[model samples]
Target: MNEQAAEIRKARFGALPERVAFEDMVEEKAVLSANHARDAYDPDGLAVRFSCLAADLGL
Candidate 1:
């Protein structure tokens, strides 16, 4: 990320978790299929990664 984006992120997230860093990088891959059905994304399989930020952030 660039300096400006880093500043914005720091302001929004306070301090990022150890999993994130100013220079850290991650590789991402996604499968693209029928365009129309993509909008109806499902996440049942990824439930373990779900976070209720509303409660965590006291929002």
Candidate 2:
């Protein structure tokens, strides 16, 4: 590529981001107890939702 094109590209998109450490990159969260009373705790809920979505989208 020409120097003018390279300069224009650099001007449009600045410097690339710095590399992040693996530990810093990942988000760590404590696992909640399965016995918690929440609607999402239902095992078949995901499957039922997915099926409904697929039907609606005609997938």
Candidate 3:
């Protein structure tokens, strides 16, 4: 993944350092509640849920 990112960066920019370094970041967790329902669709619930999450995250 780091190599891929470096390649993309190099494509945007012209050059890269002789020794490129990459650091791994802490993986993010899901902010939404996990749903176990099958064949269930709720657009309004999702909208409200995401709205609350966005507010909580100050987005």
Each prediction's RMSD to truth: 23.5, 12.9, 19.7
Clash pairs, model 3 backbone? none
In TM-score terms, candidate 2 sits at 0.46
Q: Rate the local accuracy (lDDT) of all candidates.
A: 0.70, 0.79, 0.72
State the lDDT of candidate 2 residue by residue for 1-59, as single tens digits. 69999999999998999988999988989997685565455757766656676766879
Give the C-alpha lDDT of model 1: 0.70
In angstroms, give how far residue 1 of model 1 lies from its true place. Answer: 7.6
State which candidate, 2 or 3, has the greater lDDT. 2
Q: Which candidate is the best by lDDT?
A: 2
Model 2's alpha-carbon lDDT is 0.79
Q: Name the weakest run of 10 consecutive residues (lDDT summed) in model 3.
A: 17-26
Q: Is candidate 1 or candidate 2 better by TM-score?
A: 2
lDDT of 2 at 30: 97
User: How far off is model 2, as Cα RMSD?
Assistant: 12.9
The lowest-lDDT stretch of 10 consecutive residues in candidate 1 is 38-47
- The candidates, ranked best first by TM-score, are 2, 3, 1
* Candidate rank order under lDDT: 2, 3, 1
Lowest lDDT 10-mer window, candidate 2? 35-44
TM-score of 1: 0.24
